[model samples]
Target: MRSIGLILLLCTSLDSYKILIYNSKYGHSHSNFLGSIADALVDAGHDVTSLIPVMNPKLKDGTENSKIIRIEPDQQVLDSYAKEKENYNYFELNSFNPLIAIFMGPKFPKKFEYVCRKVLDEPGLIDRLKAEHFDVYISENFDVCGTALAHAIAPKTMIGSYSSALTGQHFSEFGVPEAISYRPAAYMTSLDVHSMVDRAWNFYASLHHKYCFWFLRLSINRLMKERFGEEYPSVAEQSANVAYVLTNSEPLIEFAAPTMARVINVPGIGAKTPKPLDEYWSEVMTRRDQTILLSFGSVVKSIQLHPAVKAAIVKTISRFPSITFIWKYEEPDDEFAKEAAAKLPNLVLTKWMPQLDILAHPRLYVFITHGGMGSTQETALRGVPGIFVPIFGDQMKNAGMMEYNGFGKVFDKNNLGDADKLTATIKEVLENKKYRENAQRISKMLAKKPFSSKEQLVKYVEFAAEFGASAALRPQSVDMSFVTYHNLDVILASAACIFIFVYLICKMCSRTAVKLVALISGKTKNE
Candidate 1:
């Protein structure tokens, strides 16, 4: 048909620009996410270069049609900041992945400083990146240095973070709903319960980020001024204000904030291409059996699970014969996990399992997760209910949001006891139709977008590269005073201050009146 020919002609005329992605010094998931974006861009005829921390073997083997640049930060500098002992938070130094602590939120600031130092000291790293002459730079928001690198270069920057705008990255300033803000622990969101908490978290995080921007600007200006004769003009303003944020999420899974206009929800970045069910998993999905996929994600293996928590899961799942539990663990030789696997006929434990592949299976009835954003997005994508046991960082917030949407349940990892309670919750998710219906409804909404979410990411990056700046959805001109945003508290404080001032003035005047009366009475006594 003429229409088909014209479509082909239009596609042929569209040119792909050179794109550079930077994701260094983070978990494997972030690297994989960047790689997926790069792969997508390359497939779309774009010249793509990926900059990642030199860790996994897969990263070393550069993919065809793409140039992969590895940055091995100076080991000496890394060693200086990194704990000599194997601190779980700095686990990336040990092997292909980093060991995230049970409490990852409090430790992030130190990690940020350590990463920043590495970016500055690495010889030839910045120069090599500059040499690429990239038109656009794509990176995760947590990689502050990556954003800085993109700013240092003339290219446009698009941020892709696991935390989304919840961490006060983009949407917080733009009046996005606060219920999605970052939290220290994991919990489920109940529509009637946690919306207020979410809003409070967003308010704090927004202010925190505003402070960060000011601090970075001041530091950069001071550093540049000291080194060069002139004040740093680049530090004077945000570089291009970010064309838009490329979120690795679907809006249907969660209520997207004011950022809906700027967000490009490119879900399933790390997932395998959707294909025909291979029969093995499909067969498993059949029957009246309810199923659950349990994993902490690629970075944190199930083997690292605290023994008490592992025992709780084992004991809980043992009681349910009709429900099947699949735990993606990493101990091929560990006898403990194997023994548990042997003891529980209803549970399937494996050294490695394809998570996305499993979640997509029709039999997947529920997800027991650590509340990682990527995993939550996948859970939402499959229209599967979940039980959230957040370990640390923003996992709590993710879990809380899911609970709020009525798609999941959340519990604390620190006090994760009572196998009976967990088992009961699992049974509820399986038996109740509400969870399934809500999840399906969200899935439908996520699928309504016109194009692949990554395409939006690509378009924004191209626009930024072509146009020097993007109109910031969250403008920097707005007043950040605490009094202005949350006015009731300020009004109360002002009222109290005025009352005290007036009372003091009146007391002083009354004392003066008493003194004058006393003086007049003394004159009468003298006469």
Candidate 2:
């Protein structure tokens, strides 16, 4: 009776916090990542509120479970955003240019600064947030507005959430450790950090990424100061003060680097468990002996694919008459896509797809993907081999991992027009039994981890709420200057000491030799 009573008391005494998760409802991956965290917290019995801004109209729901408050940017911002997006082709070669990043990267966020301005100016919203007295505040670091919103709320503990793998910003601004010697950069094609050439390229790419990211962050910071008074802290300053990050990076699969204790890894935090396929999709998967699903993710549309590339893909899939190919072609009116779809009886064209449901299908043999982290992480545990076609940014790095892990191969984007190459690569993955075996092995390993991603997330949140900004976990190197951090100052000092020591010894030796010569000459004269 006493033991049972003690157990009940312990359970009752455990804390349930009021958590405010700010979802920047624009990018599918970013919003989905934050939304999942909100739902997870709510499921864990915390009070979770989702503060969302309508960055993209398509992604309307910030979170499925949390209490919602939507921020609508003025029509000017919306009009400008919609205008820019209408013409933007994210898959273009120069979309990731550093000069463009430095110059025009902030232009979009600068416009969206109105979202934060509106939030702060609203008396009712401010009063309601203050009333909540949130124990923990979490927001995506892609935009500084979300982080700035944390300042207004003044939550007990503030945290930065990364939807994808942490980049150079996490190392330079926050306390996550990154090394040029061994860690791969997200922007480059090379994944193997051990090779000298790869390391050198990584050094160059890492510097480029850091430089570009600096300007991006700088632009956002200046915009914050311009909109809100100078009293607001810089985004980097706010991130550092948090002393913790919840990232959607899987340690088991990601390129190994030094990571702080506070930077928690929860890979599947945003992933939904695969639900049973509906009748239409279930019937389609079983229609063929094997199925191949081709998708370029939400941001990178299939319609933007070069006509030659589309022709090559259509030709390659046509070679396999037994395989049922499901292609997520975003546009219904593409004349070539429509013509090819009609001729190829096995090919199915979709403007939208239940990608998760399709990937989980038993008959699904392979996936041709854009290597976006959201899809990559979700697909990795499904035991399906893929041909990764990376478009840009971290996607290239994500594609390289497919080959690194031996479950799949990285297809060169430049060779997409070559039907022969495309067909050969697809055939290789299809014929090679080892690819399937390796994928299954990795899936089982990921599934049998010590704890689930949700448990890791919940425990870390609880710990952060109780004890904010852990100095012990934060690397002192985060604040150190380049010279200091690299030990170059200490190296120069040691070099100077060594030079002086050698000079003194040489001088003594020369003096001794002169004295010896004089003594020898005198003795010879006396004799």
Instruction: Give the whole-model CA lDDT for all candidates, comma-separated.
Output: 0.61, 0.81
Q: List runs of model 1 lying over 4 Å from the truth.
A: 1-14, 55-65, 76-133, 156-163, 169-230, 233-236, 260-265, 269-271, 276-288, 470-527
lDDT of 1 by residue, 319-398 (tens): 88777777877774588877887787777777666677777777788898877877888777778898887665556567
Q: What's the lDDT for residue 203 in model 1? A: 52
Task: Estimate TM-scores for all models.
Answer: 0.73, 0.91
C-alpha lDDT (0 to 100) for residue 356 of candidate 1: 76
- List RMSD in Å for every model shown: 6.8, 3.2
